[model samples]
Target: MRLSRSFLPTLKENPAEAQITSHRLMLRAGLIRQTSAGIYAWLPAGLKVLRNIANIVRAEQDAIGAQEMLMPTLQSSELWKRSGRYDAYGPEMLRIRDRHERDLLYGPTNEEMVTDLFGQVVKSYRELPQVLYHVQWKFRDEVRPRFGVMRGREFYMKDAYSFDVDYDAAVDSYRRMMLAYLRTFQRLGVKAIPMVADTGPIGGELSHEFLVLAPTGESGVFFDGAFEEQDWLSEAVDISDRESLAKFFARMTSFYAATDEKHDEAQWAKVPPERRREGRGIEVGHIFHFGRKYTESMDISVSGPDGAPLYPEMGSYGIGVSRLVAAIIEASHDEQGIIWPQSVAPFAAVIINLKNGDAQCDEICERLYAAAPEHLLYDDRGERAGVKFADADLMGHPWQVIVGPRGAKAGIVEVKNRASGERSEMPVDAVLAHIGVGA
Candidate 1:
């Protein structure tokens, strides 16, 4: 991607409306643009990051045996009505009417719809345990939507529904998702503490919210420091075995972590002083085991092994895909701009041509771009070196390969680490090796 030819519209000054670091940096770095109060137009660079985050979320969910599928954004109001929530959901539910005067709604969540669909397909306990998920756009009418994507009216979300024949099986499904969420955030380079949280409108007996710590987070959170050392992917869990699943669930739940709403002073005191970690946090994901809440309300039933009618216990897991873009920025940005993790970085690196018109500089830049053009952003614009450096820092490329006239002539280039600000001049081949790029 050539900088001059790209559609990136970076701002020189911060927008007055951006009250948070992620919001300001997102705008200044040309990642997103506000189309309305809380709705945004994800530009090319922004969309790339969005897709990368979604892909990671998808992969983690898939690893846990969740099947990916597509769910519509618009839904029948009748579905909510069947679940006894159409009226209860209130103003946040965007109610509408089709040309035929039938009631419709922009779905905020898919609980009722998924319940109805699953009930129609699976009639017996043999299909008891099933998990389905989708990455889709959702709309909820917030009275005062603010803080960029964090509290937006329209957002991208990954919602998964799990159905099981009984309570124990349903709990196992919830714990599996909790493990998946930990691994997902670990890969994304964020520390998201799993905190006990309220079920709210989802109406569940058990719930956990994955919150990423940031100075400007909306929720106050407390957790044990042991959460910091967990390697979720490496921790082996035998989900097929009931005892193993129970043990895994115990390990995850042993930590003292809770949001403000669920914080218990007596329980919090039990944690050793040295192990206590307190901070404000932004919720990135949530998992709920609501049992037969939806199934009972919607009259969804399946036959047991004995041919007895039974309501499948259910759980719902959600990851705010679009909001994570903002949450990641909040958790990992410096004053310059966003410090993106390699797993979800839009581009692996950016090559800045200090002398764009100079033959030597252009040759080096083009060569690097040719190696992996899709993963590299080349600054070929007629801009000042300072401007190029500033923009590269603001955009938060992991590595910046600088090709000035002097280094280009010497068949060498300067490579700078975006996070560490470490600079080194090396042979072009060495530069390629350092950036993990090649011919």
Candidate 2:
């Protein structure tokens, strides 16, 4: 993508409406624009990051046996009514009436709808276990929507529902989903620890929220630093083996992690004082083992082996797909701008043409750009070297390939790691190798 031709509308100053670091940086970096109160239109760069996050969430979900499907943003109010929550959901739900005066709503969550759909199709214990998920836009009428996409009124989300034969089976599903969330966040290049959380409107007795630690986070947290030492992605766990799942669950819970709301001094003291870490955290994902809350409320049931009707034990897992963009920025940005994780960066690297009009500089940049045209952003704009450098840093690509006339002429370019601020002079031929791209 050529900067001169791209629709990136970066700003020199932050927008007045943006209060949080992520919101302010997102506006100035041209990643998103506010279209309405608490709503945004994701620009090219922002949408790329959004899709990358969603794809990782999808892949992790699929790996855990969850099947993906699309669900409507608008749902019939009848589903909520049958579950006895239509009136109780409050102002956050955007209730509407169609031409026939039939009631409808923009779904804030899909527990009731999913329960009804599952009951309509599955009738017996044979198909007792299933995990279904969808990545879609959701609307919630926040009285005061703030913090950019972090607390947006309309945002993208990935919600999955699991149905099982009984409480024990449902618990297994919850553990598997937790493992998936850990793997998902690890791959996305963020440290999100699971903490005990209230179910709230989701109405579950067992719940956990994944919080990404950040200095500017909303919730104060106390945790054991051991969480940083464990690599979830490389940990081997057999999803089908209940004993393995239980051991994994036990190990995760063994860590002392909690938000201020649920903090326990007794538990905190149990950790080695030196290994204890206190910080602020932003909630990015949540999982709940609600058992028969929805199934019983909606009267959804399956026939047991004994021919008796049994309400399926269930669980709900959610990841704020769009909010993660802001969360990642909140956790990773520095004074210059966002230092994007390679997995979710809009571009793998930006090729900054320090002398855009110079033939030798253009030749070197074009060569690097062509090596992976789709993954590279070529700054071919006729802007000053300062503007190009600032924009490259602001956009926060993992790497910046500098092509100045002097270096270009020598067939050597300077490569800088965005996160480390480390620069290396490399042969033009070695640029792709340094950035982990195939020649």
TM-scores of all predicted structures: 0.97, 0.97
**Model 1 CA lDDT for position 326:** 94
Q: Which stretches of candidate 1 lie over 4 Å from their true place?
A: 437-439
> Candidate 2: global Cα-lDDT?
0.92
Q: Candidate 1 residues 314-429, lDDT tens each?
A: 99999999999999999877888878887788888999998878998888888888988888999989989899989998999889999999878989999888888899999877
Task: Please write out the lDDT profile of model 2 over residues 371-438, one tens digit for every residue.
Answer: 89878999999989899999999989999999999888889999999999999999999889889876
Winning candidate number (lDDT): 2
Model 2 regions lying over 4 Å from their true place: none
Per-candidate RMSD, Å: 1.3, 1.3
The lowest-lDDT stretch of 10 consecutive residues in candidate 1 is 430-439
Error of 1 at 420 (Å): 1.2
